[model samples]
Target chain A: MSSPLAKPQIIAHIQKSLNYTVFDSKWIPCSAKFVCLGNFARGTGVMQIYEVQHGEAQLVKEVEKPKPIKCGTYGATSLQQRHIATGDFDGNLNIWNLESPEVAVYSAKAHKEIINCIDGVGGLGIGDGAPEIATGSRDGTVKIWDPRQRDTPVANMEPIEGETKRDCWTVAFGHAFNDQDRCVCAGYDNGDIKLFDLRNMSLRWETNIKNGVCCVEFDRKDINMNKLVATSLEGKFHVFDLRTQHSTKGFASVSEKAHKSTIWQVKHLPQNRDIFMTAGGAGNLHLWKYEYPAQRSKKDSDGVDVGVAGTVNLLQNVTLSTQPIASLDWSPDKQGLCVCSSFDQCVRVLIVTKLNVV
Target chain B: MTAEEFVSLQNQGAVIDYNGKVPVEHLDYGYIEKCKDVKYLEKILKVLRSGEEGIYPDLISFCETRLELLDPKNRLLITDKPVTTAASLSKDEWGQIVDDLKMWQEESKKTEDSLKHQPLLNDIIKENIPPIRGSNQSVDIQQKQNKNHCKRPLPRDYQEWDKFDVEKECEQIDSNSSTTSDTPAIVNTGLSKLRTTLDASFLAEREQLNLATREKDKGNEAFRAKDYEEAIAYYSRSISILPTIIAHNNRAQAEIKLKHWNNAMKDCQRVLKMEPGNIKALLRRATVYTNTGRFETAAEDLRTVLKQEPQNPAALKLLSETELKLQDEGMIKKKRKGKKILIEEVDGDDGHNEKRQGGLKGEIFWVLYIINHLSHNLYNT
Candidate 1:
């Protein structure tokens, strides 16, 4: 609902409690349905599909497996298929068909330990390239998978044989402007964010924010490199200007501290790139807007060019549940519509009123 | 547009009165559309049209766009022309500029041959440019453009997503032999060669096997507690998960204890087909046949069991009973005097030994399970 004379507001549209402990939730594209991923108390991974019907979340389908699910992505699947690729506690990657869901569409043993985060690109008509999924796991590796290939990842990023492996916590795909231009940003628990160039199969840029990174996301998946927002385990979040990267220094970034606790997730509004909402560990949601600076790049010392950082302003803040909100996603087709999962075992549908005006 | 509507919306807690004041110009399009008063729009349109052209250019265009939908005649006159200026001008110069504008528009229309690829309808106005998705640049739009075929299925199955041959991929793994640490060697799904590889399908298979074994153990537990019906049910569940000769034989033994002679016979046939000349299956089937009064077949099965294991006391005792029944039924000539002595000796400890055999029957499930497990290990090696 729009409050035309008033400013935009965040409204809790629907809240439903689940039996299992929810770890992640995502909105399915072009539909009113969303998927909730979690583990039952008895150690079974449960994937529950719910559709928003009559202002209520209706259970559409439920599937269970032997492992606990950690993360999932729809970016590697076409709109017609509507498959979900998920990572589980057993280090197994499985793509499921929502229709039958009795067997996986494709499966692979992608890692030796739990997979922490997964992102995908080149699907849903978003990118003009091969649809590939990138998964970062506790095994200290980032692997890219193509559903066309069975049982093996198409690309992998890892350390040398004997080096101590840092746990990879989050991953996201950006700069997918065309078939040849794609990059994967993987955040590790050791405060490192590595930008891997998929076309060249090399690490392009990397830097640490001095705190464990909890989540990373691009403003839009189809456009050229523009902005990336990452939240930390501490009460800090950084917004990086992906348009420019200096030779010695990495991309310029602006950091902000809020919520006074862990910032669990940061999701940009699907209809507006400049606006994003961060879910906090103390059961609060803070909305922020990024304002571009006058000049994006200028000559630094020694006549070398360096990038400029933008400023962020808080739009609103509200407390919903008294537990950490682990995952949040804005609906692809509906502006200001979102679904979030929290440690309170609740999945909530929210309407951030008047996102267009924001 | 209306004071009453504004007050109602304000009371509804959506809009707030800033410092207890309301401004007409600050109200957005959604609020105005909700009011749906045409006179309110008309009043604003009249004021915009009468104002200075440059000062109200945006409002002038907005009013024309909205009003043209209500009046089609005004639409023809509102085509692509700049708003008329209000400043005083000499008649001759104004006429000259007007004629120049018309001539340029006519020349552009006549010179259409210069613009190739006419399908791209580019608007001269910068604000009228369509979004990238509307420009047929995205992949899905291009696909939908050329499609004259039937629609793809909704919520496609995984098999519909790609034409990937899984067995062929495994075969390629065999030929290439490019084994990296993380890139596992994916073997054929049906082949037991999957045991050494930590493939996901193999893990899924092992998970099923563990569940089946658990069911089998529960069946054995039920059998120990003298719940033959529940034991048969659990055995059936285990068989449904993964068919094993041991499970069938165990189920057959339970069915025989329940006096389900026909079901026991069917289960024994299954075990025998899986492992031909199996001594336990032969003995169980002979017992079933003897219970059902098929003395000839029982004798034949017992004879086969004795040939495999001569010290099989259960088979020997059953054989003597079968022969005695055959003799009573007149199906056998009672002329072998040595056979009679052997039968008498086999029947000597019949009552006490039968109870001992029945006690040993309970251990067969564990023994068969261990044997099957060992055979599996041997196969993997």
Candidate 2:
């Protein structure tokens, strides 16, 4: 009931020219360097690695591929290796060694169509299990790949023969670090979100938002299942509490209207789990904070413990340009420092001050 | 000064000699008295005592401009009290005041009720329902008749739909058709059976082979598109349907694109077993072996390919690269041995005792060494 806290000030540090339509950006693990993947005017994908130097993004390395890259992640492999796994429009998944950018160290044809999203887990020296990557494609299938196994995927999720195939817009890995158990959460174009358990090889849970879901992300990849934020079309996003599950009602969730247009992506700060930022189709960036309930679960009439959902509070918003922000990444080593790419063919390095206070 | 004297001096517009040596200005007694009631005189006196003479003339003018209203008699006229006589009071005035207060309270209560019960404007405007006419009257009459009718009694005999035998109907149809038909039907049935047997034996294998080729063609299309994963899948499917050297060789190429060294090597091996003269398979297998640190095997494969095609540029280049890699590997081995000997010498004295004492540092050094070695290997590869 009380008014939310005063919004934080977003200070734009440096706006760099990408000269291409940037589709995705990701920060290298344990470094100030970040990678931006974009498409050139000729339709080829270009990956540029930039380092944050004196409030400016300095281009460190650039590699151009024959196909357009849709997404990339650094979570699957170890931080020491610094291998970046990327999915391309040609359905090829490739892992590049940062030291050698001329060619990928590992590559595979991962899907039948363009890969819409990719995520990785069990890396960063946090878990005992081997690192794995999950990719969702426009072909309507989500496949999990262990890089050590080169010939085929470790697991594949496709529609049954009689069922209609839906485009998978996003995929995420969660509940991975502490235990060997891991689950892949995928978002479909039909508003369906499915959580597939890798250990049991079955769909653990599924729910629909009645609107196309664009992106799905777990709060932290190296922790147990804690929270999930899913962004959808029509300017809405939902936060689900994963600590408790009900028999009839699944994980408790609360929906909130974010930007006035579609939210393209939502990324939680690497330093703070409760804080996250959403990039909107209207080129607006909104900072949000999740407030957890004092008691996560309570007994129902049937004596079953039901999860109590938390609330999402808007903290700040800033409009950088007129074009929609396609992708953004927060530096894992530096607090409040982030890089985001927009449809305007420019990548901006921003610093959100006073985030440590939140 | 006395009130009478102050008024007499003000009328004369002259000074009053207080001590014969200094003359003090006469003040308006009425104005002074009015100022005292409002506490303005005390503020003016405080200002005067501070010796700020610049504000004195303004204060004096303010008093003079309002001299008529400041008259004591005029003040008394405006301050008159209401008359206490009963003749001046209105009849039932207290009752009327109470009634008005109650009426106001009731009006506020009505407003509060309206606010609580008011429907949304959109909902109110959207509601439009027409009254039901003759159709409802007929339905009501029918319902009334149905209610008046008595319920039927249960029958003792019961029949189940599942009790009927479906085969008996088919048998009756078959008997009727057979009786009407003759030798032509039997001949047609016999010929169809023979044709089915012949197709099963001769065409099945060829059909499977055709399907495999189709799958292989799909794999080739995917490979051209650079979708090596799909190509690999298609090629695998083709191999599963009917094992062929072409499918295996194609899968190996896709695997090589993916940098699946072990898988590519296995595929190449399968192809070479089918046709030992496959130069493409040999070269691909040699590249895989070179990537996986099997230099000797890679050299052997390159030698075989060079023998088959002496003028092949790809094979020639790969052979030179393999030789350079082998030399580098030899140097790395020598360096590792040198480091191992140095470590051995450092811990040679009281071998068991020194090892226990320096184990932590040694382990840390080994980890750093291994990391450095691995990074170096990665750069060369």
Candidate 3:
């Protein structure tokens, strides 16, 4: 086998120094464009848009807002008409059109504390053509928003107050529906993965994984296989099965000493659902592959052995920087390309490949 | 390319031909303004620009000094760039430009003050500190290596791997499985458990939604029974489950009965933002504004209502009350000409510090008193 222990290839480095720390980044679904948010020099919150043309990243737009931007995600009609949605420290959420370069069409105060993560939740047939948005906040709440209505949230799932209000760190929606069923999962500071079913306003499942859950993702295209992968602060990966009414099954140690800090974000490739990448606070990103157990019985009531239902092997580990990675977002269409933001006040696009052929 | 080469190109481009392509907001204007700490900020800024292009992690340090000079209450208004004159802008456009800038500056300050309250900024600062690499030859070499590290492009496909070995490993796993080692029963248990838990969550969501609807229906029933307070409470509860303009509007009607003008005003404002053309919200806001003595704002809201419904007697009444208030005030048109005083001398008095400290205590006392007064005012309002 080609040695999977290879370093990711760096394509372009964006050298612009943000006056404030960058909180998150998102790739515009189909294009080589990306948007990021941070504090501007004036201490006011600001967002910048960048486009990767040929090989270089050129700054396309910079908009000044009122609060420090904590997280940003891109949404589109079908990966062509791009829109950027940003969550700020003051609970203000703004969704902007990349083409207009003017006022944000959708704006509202969504949370009390900083919005830790903002994800575009697709596959919800909510009548309104506008995409629904999901946001995780330090206030220990996950909210669902529709762009058409700005002031009030469509739905809010707050953690039981008496229990530890673990600040939600990240959120991802599983478009990979099993039998036309989709779900959304949010990772919390206390390492809890709570899946929410949008079709019905209900909590799907909650698990207490020892470490703080930093990132969680479900396979995008593979619908029948209800699989979930969660990365935690303790450098451990937990894969859960939503089909089976039993114990959760998969655990993969991709980078034991690869990152000196907690893993910040993880993303499954849109094109290849089996391949996934995780960004660590130690400025390292590790990729892994899950090989299904061959001896496993045929699809049971617990459903088929999904991609993450068995053993996982580390493929490549690349050192990004010393700065803790704040967030990592993969293009829903692109195969290997990804965008990562960090405390280093930089966002870089990296390419990974096999180091050597066996 | 090396870090040095990258820096030279960036600096050369910045110095010679300004790439207006990089928005003024995105430019590392901090480096330009705070040139005193050139080495540190420059290095950090370089790494950020070359790596991410737009996101900056160390912007807090740059804003620390500026943030100190501003007032917390008025921070949003004060942080505006003291307007500038451009040759491209005509003399007639000056007044509008200055007004626009001032408006945005105030807006920006409000945004900044809100940002200061976020928890993540504090976390980011605590977590992401750039490894302080001092000015050394080795450091320069490392910087070059770091630049190259992030500049590599990602692979497109399975870099068509040497599948021969992977196939062999797969064959090994396949043949070994035939020997029949015990399958981890834990896996099956965990999977089933997950499935059950997921189903429970879906059911719980439906139950919650149903409860919300029930609460909302109860509120409507109370409203129909003419029990305004009970209706308000039920509506509030329903809004907690799912906030809608109708609920807020219903609550506003109850507030009107209770004569809670300010609360009604707030509800009306919220509904207006959600549904701009809401006639009830507009009418209620006009009444609240008039009652609160904000005549101009009251008149504006009433005008909007009247425009939509020309025969709106309620809107006309509110407009008349606002106009009456405006007639009494007669606009304070005398503009205070502030002195352009310049303090060129630096104070050498240590005694000045003592005086300042004394004033600081008094100011603190005043601020505390003001906050308490404001809280009372808010409560009463």
Candidate 4:
């Protein structure tokens, strides 16, 4: 498989001495709107949502959180409703409705330490009602919550060994492919990745990398395959093939030291299953493509596993900033369009030429 | 020279007349070369060799120089003349000839200079020197060294001359006559008008430039306001009057904002094509590259920008970003080990940092703080 080569072009530039520093951002799926959060230095809350327009991005709404917001996500559902969920430094998780332009739909202090990551997927494990949100934090715990019950979490997953806790940096979930319960993946500072099967409330699998894992992402668009990508502090990226039982059969290294500093975030392209983008601590965003090698025979020769694909190649790379890029999300309508927030006090839109790769 | 040639030249209003003849004795070398007719050359020689005892010594010397031209073996040709020469003769012989000619020329000058006081001498001479003819008519020579010696004969018609004398006497009696009153005024006004016309054309050219500058500034201000349509209107108006690069760049920026990508690209390409090394055009093209998803190309533009201005913040930022995106793990590791890559990079800005003093404040302060903290060592040596 050959890596896809893409060219990145900057669309617009805005220079303002913003009151707060950007920590994370998310594109509202299927819409031109997105939300970002940081500290609004003059005593206002950290999270703000800006609507992209023809002239410039405008501050459409701002939500007050208990502490600095580290990450944010949007649930897969309606576009016009403006449902946004955010995790803050104080370990408080909040979801807001931007449709009214100003209303907090859900709020709770969910963790004892800084909340590192938050994600949501509706109409599945929640029994076809409201969307369920998941948050991971430095307190070494992952919590699943439904907005209806504002106080206690629906379920919580902690490490089984009870060893000294490592900060949980990111969390992701996807519905099982063959009548299995939904699995949650959490990445920690100790370079360990833990997956939890919510149906049995038991540990599913664990893997150790050489560096602290900063972000984790499941290929949400891939309905038939079990693939997960993770980015670590040392700029190492890992892709797992969870379809088979062999622990080592599915893993592939995308690249190592791809960024100068920490790898802050990784996201699967919303429309393309084999495409993804990663953010760096040094303020750059790189887009990548993974392709499965062509098979030669009905029965493959690799002895360990029958369905394992060998190596992955990086296709396109783009730098969206000069300061550390903390988070990134792709535009739902455009296959190659992605947005990133950086320490440079700006959000940039990058366009890629080729996202659909074999 | 023919009288008709002089008449024709005068009719065409030629300021400097070439056909006009100068006195044979006073002709300089420059005019002699301009007279190319061989027939007139013979006539001049005949006139020179036929000189009587009272012929001017100046004319005789002029004839001798022309005579030497006949001897090709002597490196001089006939009809070729010299205005002045120093022959290596014994002192007594050359000194006597020089003394005699010097005296004659001085006597002729005195007579000419006093013609205003003794008008009879002007009549006796008709002209101080004899007229030259045909190809030997060297008027430019007379103008160069002997213009003052060439006397023009006063109007020879005796009746008309007497009438001019009588009119002058009458003007003294009736000083209020209209002709007398208006003559000086017309002469003075004509002189002043000529001077003004010469100066006005130069001033007009400068004023045109000033007007163009004012119009351009108006257009530039409109561009700064982000009203691209209005700005374009103003820019077009200014460009029609006088085109400039600043206006072109402004129009290109506005076009990009309107998503007229091709138009913007063409404008930038035009500017750079006209002036390939223009800093502004290069920067504008760099931005266009970024927008078009040509990050590698954009990096080349930024590199050029940096070479010209080493501390250019925009170029540096863009360059670092592009490098980060281009990071392949193997390549990064190879580059880190300092292997020379064959990438053809663009020239960056020169080493002059514009905000050198101002930018160093934060970075320098941090460095100093670290040094101060380190000075207080936990382990006392």
Best by DockQ: 3
Q: What overall lDDT, based on C-alpha atoms, would model 3 receive against the true structure?
A: 0.58
All candidates: TM-score of chain A: 0.98, 0.96, 0.83, 0.85
Candidate 1 residues B121-196, lDDT tens each? 2222112211221111111101122223435547858976597677996887676555322221111111121111
- Over the stretch B83-140, how does candidate 4's per-residue lDDT look in tens digits? 1112433467446544543453354334324422332322322232122111111111
TM-scores for all candidates: the values are 0.49, 0.48, 0.44, 0.44
Report every candidate's CA lDDT. 0.72, 0.70, 0.58, 0.56
Q: DockQ, in order, for the candidates?
A: 0.02, 0.01, 0.02, 0.00
Candidate 1 global Cα RMSD? 34.1
Each candidate's number of clashing pairs is 0, 1, 46, 20
Q: Write the per-residue lDDT of candidate 1 for residues A99-153, one digit (tens) a residue.
A: 8899999999999999999988866545446778888899988888877777777
Calculate each model's fnat, 2 decimals.
0.00, 0.00, 0.01, 0.00
Candidate 2 runs further than 4 Å off = A1-7, A126-128, B1-381
lDDT for B373 (candidate 4)? 79
- What is residue B280's positional error in candidate 2, in angstroms? 71
